[model samples]
Target chain A: MLTSAAKTALYGAHVSLGAKMSPFGGFLMPIVYTSILDEHKAVRTAAGLFDLSHMGQLVARGPAVAEWLDRLTVNRVAGMREGQARYNIFTNERGGAHDDAILYRFPEDWLIVVNAANTAKMWELLQASKPAQVALENRTPQSALIAIQGPRAAEILAPLCGADLDGLRSYHALRTRLADGAGGVEVEIARTGYTGEDGFEIFLPAGAAPAVWERLLVAGTTHGLRPAGLGARDVLRLEAGMPLYGHELDEDITPLQAGLGWAVRWEKSDFIGKTALAAQKAADDYDRIVGVVMDGKAPARAGYAVHADGRRVGEVRSGSIAPALGGRNIATALVAKAASAPGTRLTIEIRGTEHPATVVPLPFYKRPA
Target chain B: MSQPADRFYTKEHEWVKIEGQTATVGITDYAQSSLGDIVYVELPAPGAALERGKPLGVVESVKAVSDIYAPLPGTVAEVNAAVEDDPALVNRDPFGEGWLIKVSLTGDASPDGLLDAAAYAEFVRSL
Candidate 1:
């Protein structure tokens, strides 16, 4: 077995705190600090700190960056203003999603944040698709990302940040300094998160990550902040109706099938997979993504068969016992349009037995406004 | 992670305590801790037969789903209803309240190759 894996700057701190470490995204990461339930609840009620350094960050700069990005990703990049971010996908000509990413626009460069496992593939794809005027650099090794997410995120993070976070809306980024106990560090703070809550995703120099992480935990201690892990992160994101790369999305799935049609811009002149995506949308030929709620606590896990009228109609893409939603079993699946209605009945085949489930709306849980 | 000195353990992390022909079974603390918070458990009925070292039931944790194996060939005398209703007991008290099933041994000879407490601790450490 391959024992040695990549470690983040905060690895030592996680070990000291007795975090259960596991392999994820080619790195040995904290799966949980205390328990999955407690960490998950902390994110919903108060605030939770997360180590997201395993995500891939790539920088594209120079004269033709805009045109290069337009051809590279599915979302519209030409109209994105400086300090703005757009969720996008990199796909093949067949309209299959290769990877999903968040594109951040700076004045002189574009930072594309991708899933960690797809980093090398995305880099090679961009290189092959880019024009000579564009310069590509993988800055993941030099950068670190930490997220402080929840209802109390703003109040907990306000004191240490130099930037005015009150006006920073979702998907907006600003470069500023964060005051830490050791020393202040430059960071790009973005008001965005996968947990469906108000939060900030801070990108800072890799060397200063450990200090900044410790300071954030201390600052948010009074606000009920806990060090969360990937286990909790998974349940939170699933409850929010966000799709994971390998689970809800893969090389064979398209953006439209995953209920992410809004990310694609049909008005764009040309881009990779645009032709196929336009065809798919025009014909409305793809299966629709719908939420499934089990009758009780029985969880419908990924790859479980979804049956309608005693016949297999679809398969679960992601499912979990949603903690924020009263620990109910909720799932998302790509099903036929006929069975995708809000009140349609279905059955989830788990351990060779079928359990009754109901087709609900897209997201199982939405944070109160 | 506590393991009682009297019980015998298997490489699969199950513990068995025998008294006469009946044997009580449950997973070890190391097993429950490694699996994280268990959400659901599915066990065989009281009258079902179990083969030694074969799958007996399924335990679904918040992290993943793992199969529980039978340590000795026996007939299940009783299944724990408490654990079926609230699976978190497996994490809270693995030895006492979280015991999965009580089985009546079928054959004369006990299941061989079971590890003692010390050996089980060493096996968990290697993991």
Candidate 2:
């Protein structure tokens, strides 16, 4: 079976490290190194390195950049100052999500990072809705992205970074160089991560990825850093209560129904999906997202039905045994508004039997401040 | 990751050790590695009857869920409670303490259709 899926710059490195590779989002990505549990725990306790280059990078520049972005996403893009990043979603006319993206403000252009699977679709959407004055370019292939995330992330990268990693606040980014043991290699460092822990995401030239990835692994060897794969990343994000595009937010699901109503700014005068989302907020009558913890050991996988009062109430969108939570079976579900309240009792149908579960707060885990 | 020479293997990646009329069954080394981090295992209770090529239990890893099939027609004689408590034992020792269940033979122990250690090793290589 031959696959035409694209490979990242670190493809050979992953194979050399004995990683289990699988097809994900149009790319052959590493799913695990040694084990998902070990990598998941390593990120929570020490540090973890991730290759995020498969994600799409779109840049829109010119004086109309801010105005164009304001009409494109759900968040307030105009308010973002240079060096700041904001998380937002692109919704269709029916208030359904196209993709969740991170927008970073720079002096010349607004960099939009989107999910790899939706890169082509997002590019077409941006081009069709773009203002004539604004320029749109897909920079995914030209750039490489890597993230070193955990409580000890700064301690591992500080020695190699030329800038002050300590001063950089969350959601802030800076232009810096990494010492590859010989000299400074130009890169961009952003204090952001999907895991709910302190970390830095480095963006550099695609050609420099292999060298930098090796350098970071060596630099963090004493800090218990491990090469984490997408399997660990999924569990980490789930534990942090983050929503993935395909699993949690799809074309049929809106931000409000997916527990992302906060990201949709009703205060904005006008934007895409503003009318439909406003109607949803006003009605407050639709099914909404809820976090649930199973009373038993079995995991409630996606598409599993949820029940209450012997009737179907909803379905699970994302779930797994939270390794950080000592292998607790946790999941996020879209249930009826009546069952969305925290502490509400519900039953998740795992396999063929109903398992007792309770509606809890969104985000089963949060980093201690 | 070595297959014990005394055990018989199934094409679906199951291993069986038949001693007289009692047979101990578990997954092969390749199956455990492919599953990655076994978290839970659901096995049949003692006295339950199972037919060959039928699902007798379920083994769940962090990545996926797989069915554990009965190698031959038999009734459950014993179940490994230790695996229910700590599923990692299946990954650590697939042929020893990790054995899923022991079944009492109700039909002819069909050793004819099963693969020995050498043949099973070749089958894995062909995959």
B64-118: candidate 2 lDDT, tens digit per residue: 8899989988999999999999999999989899999999998777788999999
Each prediction's Cα lDDT score? Answer: 0.89, 0.90
Per-residue CA lDDT of model 1 for A54-121, tens digit only, reads 89999999888887778867888889999998898888888888899998998778889999899989
Sliding window of 10 residues with minimal summed lDDT for model 2 chain A: A179-188
DockQ of 1: 0.73
Q: What's the TM-score of chain B for every model shown?
A: 0.96, 0.97
- Per-model TM against the reference: 0.97, 0.98
Clashing pairs in 1: none
